[model samples]
Target chain A: MTATTLETDLAGLVAQASEGAVTPAQALAEPHSLGLLGLTSLGFLRLIHAVERRYGVALDLDDDVSYLDTIGSLAAHLRERGV
Target chain B: MPTVAVRGAPGAAAPLTWGQYAIWAAIGRTAPNDHYFNLTRVLTPPDRCRPLDPDTALDRIGTALSRHPALRTRIVPAGTAPGRAPAGTDRSAVPPGSAVQQEIVAEADVAVRTVAAADEATAGSAATDLVEELAATAFDYGTEAPVRVGLVLVDGAVARVVLALCHLATDGHGADILLRDLRLALLGRTGPPPGDPGTVVAEETSAAGRDRSDGVVDTWRDAYRALPPSMFPTPRAEPQPVRWWVGRLTSPALGLAAAALAARHRTSVSSVLLAATAAMVSADGAGDRAAVLTIVGNRFDPSRRDLVATLSQEGLFTLDTSAADFADLLRPAWRESLRAYRSGYYDQLALDAALAQVSAERGEQVHPMCCFNDMRLVDLPPGPAPTAEQVRAARAATVFTWAAPQPLVGCRFCAHVTAAGPALTYQVTGDTRYLPPQRLRAFALGLEELVVAAVAGPAPLAALPARLGGAAA
Candidate 1:
């Protein structure tokens, strides 16, 4: 997936997780923890599952939180994984 | 003043459900601090823009007590013949036919302790201290009321109300119902009538036959035998006296992620979190096989859904974390959660006897190392959907979380997860000696990361630095 597509999908998941507290445009415009945007632990897990299913990439990154801090970084990481 | 005793409400007397009996049994066997109890705190500015007077406060509490039968009920030990003394304090003193009973009081004197504090914070702290003190003191199920209330005054105005209940009287959900109704009564509104316990008891009694079938008990027995002895890493020794180190993990991301996964899997968000917990514990090398005691809110019976009573029970769920891939385990985790819920409401005494039998056969005690309670479903009324201005205001407001010092019980570790708005808050308490503070905090962080990775993709799960059986890290 292209960076744009990855960002779009990540934004949708973030918005869904946040219950529309943060929008797709807002999520892509900045770098912050999705946690700050109201994405719950369960919601984040679901987002991971959604991203994996969409790109067919399995994220084995346990015990790590740096990549999940922001949408930009998450997209960058997914790009590195060739999602 | 001394507490005033009263009789139960007419027509509300009934047998204790299996769940209550299990907790009652545990309380009877354990130390003074071992009982399963809940403390709730509500802070309000004032009533109708004026200070809440003592009489008004009593009136509100009295109205609430009158509405909820569970709040006014006392435990009557089984099979002592009506109006006779309950079979003694010891478990063995009670005979086989002696089931726990609930006798609701038609009217009773409410114990309202008035504490004077300088401010809201001090008031809340005082109330919390009282809750801790009350929790350590065992309840006299044979005579005294199972519920108590504390009112804190700030600058001569009622500001904080704390309601503490023994798990025998009500579960968290029931407590919430009581509080909601109490709030309404305080506002001078008549809340809904007490939920029909008579109908609930009848339905449960009817279903008791199917619940006793051999197939159900045998399935649970097999599951218990298959479970790992303990799925948590503790210093190798007999379990020590319970001590608690509580911490909170707040994240909005986790709530949404779990919701999405739950939707995709067609399961509840709780199942998703539990699966994640099992995976996290296993990945940390707590155990290759995860055996957890999950608290199931047995409100699935529609008739009892709104009743204020103890409808929560602990159900065992075991999982194999040996899978190299985390995604491969979600389906099985969800399935096992269903099985656990289905077999949740069996007789506590019979189940304990069966567990002892299984433990003997296995040549070791088989108890879950961890306990998980999901309180997300017991939500308060939601605030109106946020407008842009409201969202900005919320963002601008300083965010702070204050957690009361809580005591731990039953097991070495217990994790209670609740939702605050879109964010998820985890209240974890455990014995720090067994689970060192640093390591426990690390495990909590790992749980968060594990969920991130579980959905991140099919990457190999990371192994913790040190296994429990290996040398101390």
Candidate 2:
């Protein structure tokens, strides 16, 4: 998928995972930190599950979790995994 | 005793969901005293709400049961796989074979025992007794539904409704949902029913589900290998007559101090309490590394959020308390807590196999028989930090006492944090052989002192043992 499309999809997933508490615009604007966008621990887990379901790629939570600190980093990691 | 017949839409038999399997394993371990797993709630309608007649209450309960199939579900041995068990077979005595499945019945009879009381005050006392009586017996999982309902009638109207639910049917969160639904049903409100358990079973059996279980097993293996052989390695005192004793510390000061620490550190109150407990565990000579089996409510998925099922499982939480100050431990505790909760959802059989493998590798059993359960549904944002004087004043109202003795639990050290009116209550039930009543009392007090001390200023980690009245580190 294209970069823009992937990010758009990711934003939607983030919004859904947060139960609409984090809007797509807010997710896009706060690309550096999803936590800053008000995503809770449960919401983070849901977002990971959504990403796995969408791309058939599992995010290794035990590894360095820095990539998960931001939407941009997560999108890059997914693409590097050939998503 | 009178029985109320509840009829619901029946579901085909399927393998027990992962959540059900987890509780099933615990039930097996807890056996005859399995009633300990029963979740009981005595709910009295608010005074503003209309008083409900016994017949109306029963009707509302039946409606609620019909809406949630999990309330009508039963676990049976695999021998009775395709259908219900034979009418007269002893369901509890039947040993489960290689597999077990849960079945939802179209209709089941629930016992409704009514206790007549003269006034509301009398009814309140009767309700408490009814809860104990209704929850004291284990459910026959193979034949009987997993719910018992009791009504306390005062002046020909229902004053309180008591529900005793088997752990196989639901956990604390699910019980809350069921109670909410019951209230709504009583008020004649209607909405779409919660998700079904069969769907959960199907999802759990899928390929992705297997992969998730594999990942969880891997996490468990790593945690087991790192944890000490046991959290409580040595017995400090002789075993009590009851083998276990429960100690409770009810303190508004602890709650205020913990909230202050949580706010200052930008962490959660659960993490603050966990850090304090770990400090005590380390000071008590368990080791610098504290391992606790934390209960995880696996309702992150929206689909399972309101599902009335036992979706809770244990997750491994380990913390290294080599830090210089107590404040430094909060962030790591919060991060590790998140990881532990994430690893909680998995197949119990797979986890068992993993534990066996780890135990064999270590040449001994590898289990952290210490647990921590934060029972609050939501951790509201903490207000501004309370001043030291305010916290000290609140400390004057703290109460620490020994509750009733309990039968042997599965764990040696179990700590539970629950809300008690305006204050917070910490109950530490431990094996007396490992933790004597004195030590249990110290542990509870130390939990309060640690947080309160931290709120006042930086509490030195090394001084915790001395402050807690334990041997110096």
Candidate 3:
């Protein structure tokens, strides 16, 4: 899949896993707010694993995901790698 | 033979050992966002009328080990098999490596073996000795080492077993399944074929892989990496391995009640547990100040099956019980817990390394010597019982992992409760030098009392230790 497609899929996954019962897309978009997305330090981890599987590439979570919280950040992340 | 499945999401960076980093980096030939920490132990009946046969035990452990492929961790590469690194987009790709993929024993060089001890006390002592020796292979970082076998002598007859695994390969629930298989194996029951569930996996992991922006943890690594030389000081002596101490507390029904309380409190069982621990830390560390670290398990994903890697991060919650109006601390704690997940910034291992480096540069203690862990939620996936290993009346048995790590703290609080289990189990490990066993019990009871009290009605604070003192002893 193109990096862009992969990014969109990941956005959907993160939004779906929103812990606070918020809309998946919103959770993907504004994960920084409290109560909007009940994502925990633990939830971030599970998402990484899921995305890695869907994309089929080794993701340096330390290098990438740690900085990408919102979908915009994630898209920017993909853009940086020429995704 | 036993079958183990890990169900959790992996994060950006969890508190991983160097051993873990090296292994993943070596295999993928690039960094991958997958790591797991697991604890496994084997127990025998309380007494032994029969001296457990080593061959039988080895067979049991081996059969149990056979079910899990160390190489079960497959990475779908970004492109063709072993082609050029897929540009930056598919920067890395791979087929399972010999070390990490296609095997249950991640590294046979360091995996564990069973040794029959002379007796119970000997077995107990031997377990540590073996751990210490085996630990020498990878001292600092906890890896996905194979099933480490230790003996638990029950009545000088049947040798109970202990399987101390690196967190990468197993978890509390998986460990329970392994133990059940071992117990059945002891009675001569064989499990399903090796790799039967995730059996038909594509042997050659496709190189065409995914983007790497999934974030559950935010390590302050880059910020630290960018820090001036002055912020990263040189270490004098390597961290001296101090005598590790451990303690235990049984929160029978207490933990579940706390979970219910958490539901009322509008948080998770883990969050409430952390809040109570925050109170305990604030109370204990003199000046009502403390730094607390909690494990955040990311097993929410349903697609990827290998949940065993060190796929977690640390959630840092600083409780300044010193804050005026102790009750108000709840709002901030709740907010922090809620935001921690949302912020996706608290990377477990990277941030820890960064903080440690920064602390050392400033010459402060690198770690918050004591920590609290509340593994109260279980991620056991329901499976149709294979008609193969049907043994009834066999209550699902589980090994207390936090129990084994107790010896390492001045005071450690471990609280875990399974949905199916009846009790809220806590293991408190400590030494006399830090505090007497009784006093540790007091601290645990005090914490439980505190949690229960808060759950009851946020009433006047009561002395937890004094209330539950006699029961722990």
Best by DockQ, which number?
A: 2
lDDT of 3 by residue, B366-466 (tens): 44434445564332111221121221112133223323322132223333333446455555544434334454556666766666555434533233224
Q: Give me the runs in candidate 3 sitting further than 4 Å from their true place.
A: A1-83, B1-38, B42-64, B71-145, B148-168, B173-245, B286-289, B304-306, B320-331, B338-353, B360-363, B377-421, B431-439, B460-473
| A-chain TM-score, model 1 | 0.81
lDDT of each model, Cα atoms only? 0.63, 0.80, 0.42
Q: What global local distance difference test value does model 1 have? A: 0.63
Candidate 1 error regions (>4 Å) = A1-83, B1-8, B11-14, B43-51, B86-100, B119-136, B198-201, B207-215, B233-244, B260-267, B284-287, B378-408, B432-434, B465-473
- Please count the clashing residue pairs in each candidate, in the order shown: 35, 0, 77
Tell me the chain A TM-score of model 3: 0.60
Candidates 1 and 2: which is better by lDDT? Answer: 2
Q: Enumerate residue pairs that collide in model 2.
A: none
Worst 10 residues of 2 chain B by lDDT: B377-386
Output DockQ, candidate 1.
0.03
Candidate 2 residues B361-444, lDDT tens each? Answer: 999998878899989754533234567888889999999988877885888989998988757899999898988888788889
How far residue B194's Cα lies from its native spot in candidate 3, in Å, is 9.8
For each candidate, the DockQ is: 0.03, 0.25, 0.08
Q: Order of candidates by lDDT, top first?
A: 2, 1, 3
lDDT of candidate 1 over B295-327, digit per residue (tens) = 877665334556788877887777777787756
User: What TM-score, over all chains together, does every model reach?
Assistant: 0.71, 0.89, 0.49
Q: List runs of model 2 lying over 4 Å from the truth.
A: A1-83, B46-49, B95-99, B385-389, B467-469
